[model samples]
Target: MHRLVLLAVDVALIVMSTLLAIVLCGPQSPLPAIANIGLYPLITIGVAIPVLWIFGLNRTVWRFTSLNDCWLVLAAAVWIVVFSIAGNFAFDGVQGIPGSLPVMQGLLILCMLVGVRAAMRLRHSVRRRGRMARALFRDERENVLLVGLNPIADLFLRCAAENAREHIHIAGILSNAERHHGRSLRSCKILGPPEAAEEVLHELSVHGIRIDRIVLAMPHAHLSRSAQEALAEIERTGAIRVDQLSAQYGLSELMFDSAARVRVAGSEPSVIAASPLSSGELPASSYLRWKRLIDATTAGIGIVCLVPLMLIIGAIVLLDVGYPLIFWQQRPGALGRPIRVLKFRTMRRARDRSGRNLTDAERVSKVGKLLRRLRLDELPQVYNVLLGHMSLVGPRPLLPVDQPSFSAARLRLRPGLTGWAQINGGRHLSAEDKAALDLWYIRNASFALDMLILLNTAKTVLFGERIDHRAIEEAWRDLRS
Candidate 1:
């Protein structure tokens, strides 16, 4: 899966480089002359993919690509140029295209291939730096999962808990030894064997508990394959970071008292603070990470799938309302940050070229009203989802004036296109009532519940909204409790 995605990205980069080489090599106004540059581009790509693959370009991980790999990249560029020209010669004797176009294209492809890898390496470096930096100043406690249970683990847990400055809560422990199952160390339960890491994570996610990071209790070289796989899976999901507790760490200074004192002078941090669900710094756990990945991927695919429908809607709006095909407004997003929400323009200008103002009914076109009824206007906000402004299911983003008083909690999660409130009572629910239901989602969020809300959304759209007074009351009761 990873290699396939890399191959696709390379192909796209090669195609883009081809176009750029043509434009830069050709005379100005390259559009009119593109017809002359015909089959050569197609022939070039046919030769390039196999040649690049043969050079083993796709085998290297972009994030870890180094100077040692540059020779291979350079060799791939040379072969692409050679075979492309040969393919063109075989196809049509290489007559019409510019003589230097292939060379230019090859060089451009080489630069882009290397440039993208460099960018990936930089992003990886930046994220690591950001985490190290955040740990220094963040007042919120981190939820930690221990990957092994041993004497080393025992000492680390004891020191962390007893240290006055340790702002960490030990969620549980995972041991490779079956003997440690159902055991307890320093009031921390051995959740299960290391192989059940994913299962343990999912169980925590249901109750809004997310492990910020996993610490290997023993040496890296001594860990078992199952322990390694568990860590890799967790890291790959981007859910939690994994670190090893070195002998030097315990010898030099514990993560708590001494380090904390050195990092911040004369300040105290909460020792073993409660779950982050209350701190507003929600852990990027299994569900939150999967939700983001799903939201972005689904929205991106949805935009591609709905492009034709969107174009049709745009045409209707243009024909009826004229210009400015999209309507955008600022709405309060996650944590009250402002974000621009986009939709197809469903209304005409308030007033025409005339001096008189128009009525609200006059502003809305019949086509617009129909779009509202069908909820097609919400389609454009999928791009918002792709952009990280919203999710597929959550609380709706409200205008500043319309937001509920308890919006701070609602905003903990990003506003969604369709939410629990939308599928439940929708517009009929009072502001406070909607807020209560949204709060319920914040506390007990899980992938299963999100899927349920999405399934019900279809029913709500087809057969108007349903009101559940009991559910609303239950939400309020949970919140108060």
Candidate 2:
């Protein structure tokens, strides 16, 4: 039902925006071209509907949708207009059609795509402010049957409690394995496991209860092929939807694999599980699709816009540090994986007695110091953002040695170039302090918070507020003691 709602909303918005764009900006000397033509809007919309879906815009949930998603649609619109115009110019030699048509077309596309979305967001914001904040129940609370009672399951349960406002009620827990049958979980009684799935579903459905969704709390590390297949078969019954909640958020396997809730051979194959707590949560596909679209668009534009500045910086770094101006290091990435981190080297070469190395401050060259002061050293990480290895905002990645202890916390998220810590305390923070900020970010990360952080980062960097290094030293010393 939620999926259907999203689809309807997306289609309506897309069509309306397309029509508005044409009416407002379509090529015409005195009157709008779109108002005169009856079929052009329809044709453009028809063509754009598939493009939007292919770009995964409609696939996004309206609630958790971000500006990045809007940016993606905008980029796709630009591509559509640019390519069409270029083809017209190249093949048709641009003699017949007015140049204003392409310009108006591009403008109309951008305005409609962005403006309608903005209006929808305003409506959502107003609704949220007026509402008492609760998820709408369908007849009754969602009848959820959880398969495991492990720590990950517990976390999911906690998520359920937090989002109970969303109306998910645990029907009970089940464990087909003999070892788990007798165990108790809080208020939930442990029924039998996989073998007893049918009997349990029967009893629940008979008593005015509907098993809306089945939850698998099996951690990725402990999942087996047969168990997975069994769950798949159960979901295939169409009687209920199946979801998996696992602790493999940072597992390298996912890097090479698709999301947990992917369709395989026309079936909604279990890929990644929805957060047991995220009832009506935005799908992962929404984020992946929008993030890629935004990253590509932003990076392309940023590179073009910042070309002169980047060149100037490159020349400075080369002259000041000699050759190999860019500093690239392997850093732990999303899901505890590895990716190359790029920055303008902010340090000079300085070796210790063993010829091994020196600390950050000691190695930092004079030019590097100036770069660090301006935070210009980090501009290169925009490429990491472009490559999808990082986000413009997220938990900052850690060096491998710096990551293992906080693996669980960091694994819960994708690493970012600038994050809560960067905006809050940045270089002035101790490891523990940084962790606290990261955890805080993990706890309250939202589109609004990210925007606030981005704004603060700009302020802090442009103002050149030197970090309270003294405070960081004191915090580090206290932690050591």
Candidate 3:
């Protein structure tokens, strides 16, 4: 039900934004002959919405949406402008469309969409205020003990306080002694350390105060053995339900630009092993619905927009290299099954004297080389995603024969067009680095991480940034050494 409502909001924003863009671009409407331009608004919405998904905008709850999210929307808008201009220049074949129109359209569309979200935020703020005030006025406020104060939970509490809404009034902060006992953080006194959590809870309950949710807001570092043990003890009391703040808001220490240290006594730090075959892990099918929905939507749109370009490329490949313009090869699919992956043939059909195929770098033709460099070759795999054999973002699929130990470990899930490995090291990554990244992704795959990787992929491609091939290889070598 929550997802359905969110999806509805997403579709609404796309349509509203596109219509608003058209209106902001010029007169009440385009000239009758060019009134076909009105359809462009829908087209723009079609493009923008998927781009928003690619950027993982909807992953964020409205209350927690931040400036960084807005930047992503703005960047997606910019991409829409570029893709629109490029598509027009290459094909559209029509004249008299406003030169500045698309850019203006993108800006206005983004502003409107952002405005709608902002308006929701304002409403939320007012409602929270009303609730807080009501709680205070009715003397119905509970002595609320907030456990963690991470950014997201902080924002919610702040909203409540600012509005004076009738809700659980904050009594104090409950955290580890090292973090809050000796320090001043946002006016809330740290009443007791996590080690003293039970004593504190008992004291509150005995004093006729009721404890609600224990909002877990510690950084990833703070989620160490000591913290977990303390939290475990807290949980045993059956006095509070632990609402994990970091996981809910996607707020980790890495998300912050600043650095902070976590002190863990007598514990050795180790990297998460990179492998698809991790034990006791959930099946990738758990997210299959999300994967398929995104794939179908993205690929459907991509194929429509790229049909003309595909036609031209198809012609060039046919004339230059004869038959079989599309290349398909067997690669590992989800759970190590075999699937035929598709790409535009960038290599010739030449074989060795033994009748074996030549290596990729060797058989790769001039046009193919250009296509590979620009990533036009992989355009066809969008279909693979649509067909459910692949995903827009996950661990990049590897050839069955080249299967490294880690892929077998990681192939517990489906392969993706772009993933943690692709963004971090790409073609430059070593098996070990790829494994680590893939495993990390498997452990932490979410709507937002996928979006971040997709955005990063765009940045890498557009700027011609060298994939950190050296770093990847070195990481492998270091592991072996």
Candidate 4:
């Protein structure tokens, strides 16, 4: 019912904006003659409604509308303008409508759509601020001490800043970097290094500032030994409870919800799970069934829509790399099962004197580089997804040699074309970092998180920001300490 209302509103707004644009651009007052207008305004609205639908604007939550959402709206508006102009030229020609009408309609429609959504967001924000003020005055919010000042930590602080009704109030930050000692994040001062957590707690206590919880916001793989020790020490003290914010928590809190509910914690150091999954054990959840359904649907649609492109890419690969256009590798899939993953061959079949394969840089062809840059090489994996050996979103399957580095929990799920780790840092992350991300996904598998991963994956692929193996290895070595 609400969607129906929103759809109607969208259609009405598009039509009204088109009419207004026509009037504003007209030399004569009011609307132009019936002959002059012809189907111009009608055609403009017609193009706009479908374009907006394609962009899923009517279904977007206005209160949570973001820059990405606005971009989609802008894209839709541009499409509407281009299509309408072509439509006018084809149907009415220059004599039928003014040249500036379509341009004016596009700008007006874009402003109306984005402006309305922004207004909705502003209203929600104001209401949330009021609630937050009440909560702050009553001292009812949980005082949280954020540990780590990484991207995840920065995201958390951003959420707190944007939403006033958030249940967690960032009291201070504890970072491992010495340069961040006196810096502040979103008005919260960096208290000290993680090693000085206890001292900071005592000082805060002395100053009558009580911290209800200590949240470890860094990636598990990135947590240093000292930071882990600090978490253990803080947990043992029991003065303030400790919570390790996983990818699930961070994403949910930052993107979907203003307040993320705390997961149940066992009476142990929060750094390590009490009963980590071992080999042969899979975490059971209904969400996995939903995830599989999503994987199948998306992969099926993708294969159908991209068949022509796939054929073209296959031809290009064949010409560039010869014969076998598709390369197959035996990767460890769900539950340590061997699965043949398919991809467009991006490298030549070159070997060294010992018959071992040459380095990737030596064998990679120009066409392969372009295919990889656009991530078109992975299109063949749609078959793997359909065959049920993989998912659209999950941990990247590891080679047998790399399996030991990842936890059993990560291996329990089906491998993916793109995963949490891939979107977060992609090939740049270390084995441990990837393992940590995969473990987080395994524990918090949900339809929402899967969608978020897919969205981020699109952004990552579109921007061509994938890091090289040498850089990844260097980062791993540098951060391993």
Candidate 5:
């Protein structure tokens, strides 16, 4: 009975939009000559209602229609128009129906179907409708402030609108650019810069909206000393919380637990034989100790001196693709723990709003190709070295799904920015081959081997990744032995 009623309501909507389309297409009212008007709409109605039934679209809760529902609505619209036109042609002609009427009516039906559902959602939660919504039913919604002027802020807004309306009411956005101040993103006001966050919080409180949380959307942001002092003052309030988007999403540093460290550090691998040395035992060794010191010194100096170059690359990425200057992913580190791997974004968005996947070649821009060729994309990884999630030289980290069974061999030590496998074969090597070459590096780990890998890395960048089958065969022999 409930399904029948919903179907009837949709039919009524279809009828109304069909009439509106006809009237707008013609000069006069479609009311009086309704009897004389063609059967285009009659066929449309006959085909559309069942299409709606088949799609199960009437079952969707309008107040929370999701993106999937929108796609279903789109598909139903296309099929309705195609079948309706076919039905008209089968009847010999659509008398009195203009050629363009069916197309216009189809579009109108789509808009009305999606719009009515969206309206219900807006009425259910937006902040501007807060007073009326409270009168209807009360729910605790956090007055949240978002910091960042990047694409991530926009992503968060869409997500919160679709999912967290009852629990989060975004107060406003804080941008890093002065030009964007007094502007709006997704209808939420861009209050000002992060430097003015304390001032904005005060202003918002004065206007009766108290922010309970602030989320940092950008990966990196710069602030003056006075601004940092101001933020410290806000932090002292003890009433608000600061959150990082990456931490909230559980993107990195999650693979490390006390137990995992104990297991990976002690386990003997079948592929790569290693001395029974843990992280502590290694630090006492002079060579191992110096490796960490060298990694730190090099990364600290490199980061400072490369700032201007990184900035130039950042601008190219922004103009070539869009927001999100940094791209990060979770990859395994030492002791089976994971680190948040960082790099500059090198491709366009993975998919469109409609959820259509794009090919890699299609998404790769000229700037991205150049960055990959010059190896500048790996520059951001120096920060990881500074943070000690990785070493200056070791086996490269691979995504968990892509790793082979012998991947534990690669994780025997901290992952590196460049390694034996990368310098010898890099992108040209298969996963199995990469595992073997990395095992060879593990067996022969030393200061001389590390220097050799670093020097070859320069050659690989100048030339290109070279595949050496002899190296792979030698590593495989050692593994079998």
Candidate 6:
């Protein structure tokens, strides 16, 4: 019902924008001649609705409309103008609609679409700020002192700020760099180096600043010796709680009781794996049921909606590369079980003189590259989701040969069409790096995290940004050490 209302509004906006453009662009009013061009206007509407739907304009949640959504609206409007112009030329030659009219119509449509969404975003922001201010005034918030001046730390700070309902006040940052001391990040000051952790806490307390939590934003693998000592000392003090932000697994508050015992030494702390999930360590049955339900519903709707596109791609692939369009490979599924995963054959079955297959770069066809770029090749994996062999969002299934490297923790979760690692670094990541990401996902799986991954995947697919694998590998190694 909500969708219907949005659709109606969209159509009305498109029509009104076109009419307004005609009036504004032409020397004389085109209202009387609108009767003559009624067929073209109807054609415009017919072309626009589907184009807008294809661009996901109707599906965009207005309250959460972002720059990406605005871009989609612009793209859809451009397509509408292009299609309308083509229709005008085809139906009534150059005498039909003015070329300038289409251009003006497209501009107006883009403005209206983006304007409405922008207004909603503005209103939401204003309300959120108001709520945050009120909550802060009421002292209904936890003052958090974040440690580290890294990207992960920045992300945490941003997330906390955006979530007004959470009422997490970031008091300041504590970094290892002496130069960064007294510096500010997003208005949160950097207190001091790791050695100053105790001093800073005491100072905040002395100033009547109640720090309810101290968040160590550095990844567990990268926790510095001084940071570790500071954490240990903080634990010993027992006045405030400490939280460790694992970039791989997500942020977790480590109470002294539950925190893994660590000795402060000159060396880096060893990366401790989470306990294996046994019969006694399973997730709640209700959560598992809900996850399965989400997977099934997403896959079912995806298959139904995308069948036509898939069929078209299949025909093209058959013509381009000859028979057998679907490529099947054995991959590690839930609990290390072998499952046959399906994808559109993106590479030609080409071999070298030595009877060995060529590299992926050599075997990949032009159409295959396009399919991969658009991520259209993975559409067949919906079948795997429906068959319970995979999930809509989880760790990407690994080849049987690659399975041995992954921890048992990763194997416990169903492999997905898209995952945290894929969105982060994709094919650029090393085996160990990917495994770490997978293990992290398994440990910190949640509905919100899954949705975030899906949203990021959509953005990645839409905008073909290559992941810097080398840089990611270096960062991962640094975090681990």
- TM-score top scorer: 6
Ranking by TM-score: 6, 4, 1, 5, 3, 2
lDDT of 3: 0.66
Please give each candidate's TM-score. 0.47, 0.39, 0.42, 0.51, 0.43, 0.53
Q: Candidate 4: minimum summed lDDT over ten consecutive residues — where?
A: 261-270
Q: Per-residue alpha-carbon lDDT of model 6 for 210-319, expressed as tens digits?
A: 88888877754455777678778787777788777674445543321233432222332234232333221445445566898889888866865776798799999998
Q: Is candidate 2 or candidate 6 better by lDDT?
A: 6
Backbone clash total for model 2 is: 12
Off by over 4 Å in 1: 1-16, 20-285
Q: In candidate 6, which residue ranges exceed 4 Å CA deviation?
A: 220-229, 236-238, 247-481
Lowest summed lDDT window (length 10), candidate 2: 269-278
The model with the greater lDDT, 1 or 3, is: 1
59-134, model 2: which lDDT tens digit per residue? 6654545878877777667655654544444444544344455566667666766666677777876675444244
Steric clash pairs (candidate 5): none
Error of 5 at 214 (Å): 38
Root-mean-square deviation of every model: 19.4, 17.7, 15.0, 18.8, 21.5, 18.0
Candidate 3 lDDT at 312 equals: 85
Give the least accurate 10-residue stretch of model 3, judged by summed lDDT. 267-276
Enumerate clash totals for all models, in the order shown. 0, 12, 17, 0, 0, 2
Please give, for residues 1-481, the per-residue lDDT of candidate 5 as tens digits: 8888878877788888778878877655667545456676788789878679757888988878889898888867876777777777778476676677778878988998899889987876564467536733764788889887665677789988766666788899987779999999988999988889888998998998989998877543344566566666777865887777856775333232224433333334554443222122232335765788888889867865776698799898899889888898998788678888888989999996788998999788888998989889888898788768888898888787776654555677788999988987888888767877877777667898899889999998999989878888987787666
Put down candidate 1 lDDT per residue, 1-481, tens digits, no spaces.
8777777788888888888888888875778545677677787678667656645678897777889777778767766776677667767786667877877898899999999999998897777656545664674668999877666687779877644223677889998778878889888989998778889989988978889988887666666788678679889976698888865475433332322321212322121122234345554557986889999878856865776698788888899888888788999898778999988888888887876799988899899988887788778898789768899988899888787544556788999988887877988988767877877777777889889998888888788878988888787677666
